[model samples]
Target: MDRQEKRAFVAFLAEVFASTSIVIVTENKGLTVADVTELRRRIRATGSTYKVAKNRLVSRALEGTQFDGIAPLLKGPTALSWGADPAAMAKVLVEFAKTNENLVVLGGALGSQTLDASGVKALAELPSLDELRAKLVGMLNTPATRIAGAVQAPAGQLARVFGAYSKSEAA
Candidate 1:
């Protein structure tokens, strides 16, 4: 790329780093275009993004950003995937790396915290934001349902008792 284009890319990456909550770096040593395309598709499905970039340009983008700690992990042919949800991004990378040996999970940064490959894997194991929200909603709804059932049980029993009394009185 020319100087202007490189500068523009660096600016764009810097802005992305500033906005995103998670950034995962991977070494795509021998991944084919099809593999990358598939990876991108899966990541995009989760509202994340994956991009292959020059280490030097990435380093420039890391300057003064919260992700600067990941600069050391940017050696060789590396790509970055980032998103608002930390678990979602890590899950995609870790799962893809499991299927594709060529894609190595180097490391990443969650906000200002730098994570090793193992840390990234651990993050992946955690439930995603949407999953956690769903679980929370379920938990909340369960108590309300139980409360409704408890409230109705006494009324139902009372109705049954009144019906039994009326039948006995008629007899």
Candidate 2:
């Protein structure tokens, strides 16, 4: 590519490295367009972006960034999966990798924290952002639900009793 294109990509990658909560680097060698399109669609569905970029530009982008730890892994047919929600992206990549044999995950970076293969695996296994939010909402709603049930119990019993009395009077 031209120098201007490279510079623009570097700038873009630098911004991504800065803003993203997590970045997963992969070697997507020999992956077909169909596979890539599927992966792209999945990433876009989750408000994420997947890019196959040149190593030089990626290396330049990693300069002085928090995710500089991942710079070295940019070699080969490197594709980056990045988004605002790191957990979601990781989960999606891991799940996608289960079926797509061509995509090999090298490692990743979660902010300043560097993740090895095992770290990435662990992250993949953890509940996603949406799952965590759902769990939290369930936890918060539980007490309210219980309280409503408790409050309605006596009224329900009283209504049942009155209904039975009226039925007996008719008998």
TM-score of 2: 0.91
What are the clashing pairs of model 2? Answer: none
> What C-alpha lDDT do the candidate models reach, one value each?
0.96, 0.87
Off by over 4 Å in 2: 166-171
Query: What does candidate 1's lDDT look like per residue over 3-67, in tens digits?
Result: 99999999999999999988999999999999999999999988999999999999999999999
Candidate 1 residue-wise lDDT at 32: 98
Model 1 ranges off by over 4 Å: none
* Tens-place lDDT digits, model 2, residues 36-138: 9999998888889999988887888999989899987877898988987777787778888889989888899998999977788888888878889999999
